[model samples]
Target: MSIWWSLHLRRDAASVPLARRLLLGTMETAGVDPDVSYDLSVALSEACANAVEHGGDTPDGPSEAYRVTAYLDGEKCRIEVTDSGPGFPATRDRPSIRPARTDAEHGRGLCLIQELADHVHIGNKPGRGGAVVSFDKILKWREDAPLMAV
Candidate 1:
């Protein structure tokens, strides 16, 4: 896995899919397993959507210029996405799944992120414009779980 990495891009609702793909590619390039890369894509997408829907309207504020950065150490991977809007502490109250129902596109992103990431943190960005979602992939797993030995 790569020891260092980063990505920055403008925030536009239309760019959400692109943002996800970019993050996925970055993780893959860093030698992450494909399933792990896909998980990061989904997590970043959910976090970005929150920034867009709830953060400020300024450029880079969710609907504005959104930036996502990801990196890996020997045992873990982490991602941080920044947007222009500001928010209070985030709750993992990401909504539940209803896979059989169509037209139910509004929620479910954070919920998925929360489930996949070994650890997740949400907070306001250090600067004036936005917030960040911090996620980590742990080095170890439950006894019966599959291993990501890469």
Candidate 2:
């Protein structure tokens, strides 16, 4: 069975946990292995937090909202977070993705997402204005998972 969900959420700090909780609940319901679920949820949280922080504000003001989407199909799960802020810098001008300075609290979210997910893509939405952070992992199911039996 395949499953998917999406949310259009306001760019607020509170929305971070909301997205993470929902992802956790869904993974639990689907009988995914706890360790796999935890890793994916943590990555989702980082992506959501980034959207809430950097996903808004045009010259006029904050854009007001962002989007999160998750998909579970066969042996894989994918999640994407999108924001309406100034998109990432062009590739030629973009800084390399790396760990933040040890003394820095900020700038670590992207790194965390990269470390958790099997495949990650971060870039601006084509023909529009926003950033998209997407990642996916190979899912592991619980021994008694109904989906596995199906």
Instruction: Name model 2 segments beyond 4 Å from true.
Output: 93-95
Compute the lDDT of residue 62 as modeled in candidate 1. 33
Candidate 2's displacement at residue 97, Å, is 1.3
Residue pairs of candidate 1 with colliding backbone atoms: 11-64, 11-65, 11-66, 56-85, 59-65, 60-64, 60-65, 60-84, 61-84, 84-129
Q: Candidate 1: worst 10 consecutive residues by lDDT?
A: 139-148
How many residue pairs collide in each prediction?
10, 0
Candidate 1 local lDDT, 1-150, one digit each (tens): 345556566555776787787776655555566777777778878887776677656554335466777766666888887767765445575323333335676666666778889887766666563677788885442234333344
> lDDT per residue, candidate 2, 1-150, as tens digits?
899999999999999889999999998988999999999999998998888888878766888999999999889999999988998887774435788999997999889988999999898887767899999999999987877525
Q: Highest TM-score among the candidates is held by which one?
A: 2
Off by over 4 Å in 1: 58-63, 89-105, 126-129, 139-150
Candidates' C-alpha lDDT = 0.66, 0.89
